[model samples]
Target: MAMIHDSIVKEDVVEHKLGFYPRIPADSIFTRENVTARTKLRAHLNTPLHLATMENKPNSIALLLSMGCRLSYNNLDMSAIDYAIYYKFPEAALAMVTHEQRAKEVMALRSDRHPCVTLALIAYMPRVFEAVQDKCITKANCKKDSKSFYIKYSFDALCPQLKMEDGNNVRRKSENVPKSQNIPLPALNIKYSFKFYQRSKLEVDALRLALNDPKYRPEPLCVINAMVAHGRVELLAHPLSQKYLQMKWHSYGKYFHLANLLFYCIFLIFVTVYTYLLMGSSENYSHTKKAAKCNLSDPMTFDRENKTEKNNVFNSDFESKVAMYTSTVAILAYNAICLIREAYNVKQQKWHYLVDPSNLVSWLLYISSTLMVIPTICNYFEEIQFSAASITVFLSWFELLLLLQRFDQVGIYVVMFLEILQTLIKVLMVFSILIIAFGMAFYILLSKVGPDETGHHLSFNSIPMSLMRTFAMMLGELDFVGTYVQPYYKSETDILLPFPMPTFFILGIFMVLMPILLMNLLIGLAVGDIESVRRNAQLKRLAMQVVLHTELERKLPAILLEKVDKDELIEYPNNKKCKLGFLDLILRKWFCNPFTDDAGLDLVLESSEDYITAELEKQKRKLRDISLVLEQQHTLVRLIVQKMEIKTEADDVDEGVSPGDTRVVPRWSSPRIRKKLRTASSFNK
Candidate 1:
């Protein structure tokens, strides 16, 4: 390896044809096309750049470039920077991208290199990601004649197992071995006329890559999760990203919706029925007993008691039957299935899975539902059973509501709700101290008070209760008379309320701050959050749609996936029209206009006129640049021809002056013809 590198670096002799057009002799031997050549500790068909990048030698790369070593990609369609990104060597990649010559000229000219955006994102190399963007799109690096780019990043090949088997970047059979990289994607045309283009200020190249590819290709779920995790939420609003997500939605999204709907519907029915039967039967029997006791003096009391006994007997009979147990088991089984799916995702996505709000909520619901059933099986107290059952029911229904957001038509509302809720929580977090202070004050003031005429205790007797009351007041539920006035008036004057004036002052402040100022501020923030969500509703919906589609794909059968999978070049708006089959018609009708309408799909792809115009402008720029280069070359050739002609004329003049001619040059013959020569000859004679 050292000898090979030394040979490449030391061979500095240049051969010139016309004293100006120089070519490096070493380029012929150590050329980009010569891949079969091997060296110690280097893989077959690897170049010096590949070796340098693999070993993380930035200086060696710099020296090789300075020696006129072209930054040509090897057989893998990978440039030196690609190899650096693949091997997780950010410094080496940075070195290559930061080099003036390599970055501006070589990288610009070589648009065929594998797309490094996905790899950089996956590796979380922000600096390298930015550098690559600068190389590809920045004004200093983009050339007019640069090729139209189409990056076919293949996610199927990004698996670690495939990375190892595909020996495109592996080392030779030696002590050292090279590691690997991830992600595959479709072609994206980032080339645009520089006149109309400007680099984006946002650091969201990964999300742009995810959504901006020219081909409406589906990326892996992990990539989307990475975007969210890294907070590239701003660029999700790009038109291309929105269009890409719409394509994914139309692919197999309807089927996912139907499947989830069916499954959840069944689970919810079982949950509702089980909860109603368990809670209703016991409560109704107790209510009947209370009625019978109150009407004991009446003649119908004995008859009512008999009827209540019969009803209680009937309730007991049904509660112990197989039908009830069947529902319990069904609910349990549904939860178990959901739990297993969550567990599988957790195993696959690990940290990302754990952090997702939807996943966390689903886990919570599953656990609560499972615990809800345990009380019945073990015959716990009725109050405890009701408490568990009530929680389980609320969460199950709420889970259904959340699942409904998988559809774009309804997702916007859920997004708005969540956005407002998030704002409200943040506002509350900042002002929660006021609530605590007021709640503690109320607890002290009301702790000494007794129940009212209706036999209800003052609601602020405890700190938690007081806080709850204050929060309620913040929401416009202030029971002023009951909380303060009635508590004071109902108590005796002998009770000697010590801090009435101070309490009133604090109460006035609490009312002003909590109900008026803080509540209005919260409302304003909620309004702003809603507007922001509305502005970004499309992006948020697409992101949610991505998550839904990914989950659907994971749950779908392979056969169905094979049937529904899209081709590489998905022609939008006119992509195979919906068939007249029953299922197709149902899906079309169900997801019309907003999702499956042809006109709506047409909006996803850029208009042909715009695309053609941009492309033509780019071509014109390229042609102009080409003509400029050719003109310069032509002028240089003319100068060379002029110099050569002058030399030829001088030679002709020299040839014209024959040896006997003494007119023009009379060169070395002067020695014989000189006067001194004649005088010397005479002296010698």
Candidate 2:
């Protein structure tokens, strides 16, 4: 059945591409004399509009709508706009809203019990969204329909149901009767039958399934990500949205997140201590041995016992091993916790889980830690083990810092650094080609140059080395005289000669292009966007807060969730009058966001103020438009009254009544009526 539906949709797409469904002429469908007939015809032809919408044919849908086709649901209880949004055809959905002032209807339509705004959010149609905002909720409306802000349903409640059909057979006859006259006919079943279940999985499986299933969780996440990606964080700042965020945060979100951060800190400490011990062991081993490189293949030189200083770290291997083992246990415990979290995200977020950079780092650390756990590998390959341990240590701490970024207090700084880092990467990408060109040029020019004064090989002797040297030069380490003054060996004469003029010229250009030009350009670019970076960083921080809180809500236990969830408007304190615990009071005093010292309530209030201002502006524009319409109507009315008076005067004069005589006038031409009309015209103006 699914395959059939897909094939039909595809065929419609092909026909649309081939122009088989061209726009119908309005004259053929509707009479020029009567609009009532057109309305009746359009009402009957709404099925075609629904069909066009289901097929995702935006042009056909628009054409049908232009002919006066109305938006309505078919027998399946799903409307055309619902089909468009459910299938994620943005053009098809936008066509409906952008035409014939149908945005209100589209916004009002409910798909799978969720407001059209919910699905429309995923579509990210600005015009469609704007239409919904036209009727912005005021204080009165918020009080009246406050319950509308909270959705009392599970995530799967938003998923559209698919209908399936199957043949049924095998009839068993059983007749119901009174207590004294019961009868039953039992026989052998002749055929088989099947039952179709709409939703077979448990409620717990809904989120997990939705992660990978397009019909479920992805739609919700898509709306969120779309807003964030487009820098539409202001949408998330809606009063209802902020209330939801606050509810989630004040519930188990803050506690769970803080606990998780604390655990990670402990893990980092363990990793740090483990790395310190390893480094200390290596350092002491280095000090104990003579300053001579030993061949790895020789067993005699590899003996550590023979060349040990009295205070070598290996002398206390017993105590060191004990400490290492203790730290390893703690690290492993934290790794287990991390593994559980990763598994949960994988099951509930699917591919979305991997989008986070920290997840990748955690996986890398996980693998490295697992390899390090094997005693044999660590003992036999000490160098490789140490290298892996070093990376693991760095990543563990870096991941902790990233986790800390979820907190708004510390997040701004991290966000600013990320913004700058991104700018730096772009700058480097643009200048990379120039740097490589210089590196290659230097390698070609100075490859034949002999060792420098101390008999050390010149920096530009090899291609890789030349690139490193060129990059270093860009950082103000120009060894210009040292590099250019080197001599090239003459093989035949067995003597050294100085470099030619071309080398000096190349050095001068390198100095100009790299250290002098590129360095300053990078610095200036990084500094120029500091203000914008700070502004964007705040928005990004809010977006992160939204994502974090939403995810926390999803992870909450359903039973406890109902208890924690707020279904009403959150009334924030106007001032800091409420008392707090000693620890919280201290923390709030020191760690609150500087820009919003009143505990995020100020930010919420600001958002609400913006919303109120926008609503007022919209109302003002509407009133102005209405006033213009009334002025036009008043003008038409005055013109009709003037024409009537002119005819009346001409008739009165033709009838030979004295010009001074006042005959009984009709109420329509009375002074009172004229005066009222004039007053209305003036008021409208």
Q: Kindly list the per-residue Cα lDDT of model 2 for residues 254-344, writing each as its tens digit.
A: 6678777777788788788887877776775675454335445665755654455333644577677677778878877777877898899
lDDT by candidate, in order shown: 0.57, 0.57
Q: Name model 1 segments beyond 4 Å from true.
A: 1-253, 287-323, 370-381, 449-457, 481-498, 552-576, 579-685
Every candidate's CA RMSD: 18.7, 16.2
Q: TM-score of every model?
A: 0.57, 0.60
Q: How good is model 2 by TM-score?
A: 0.60
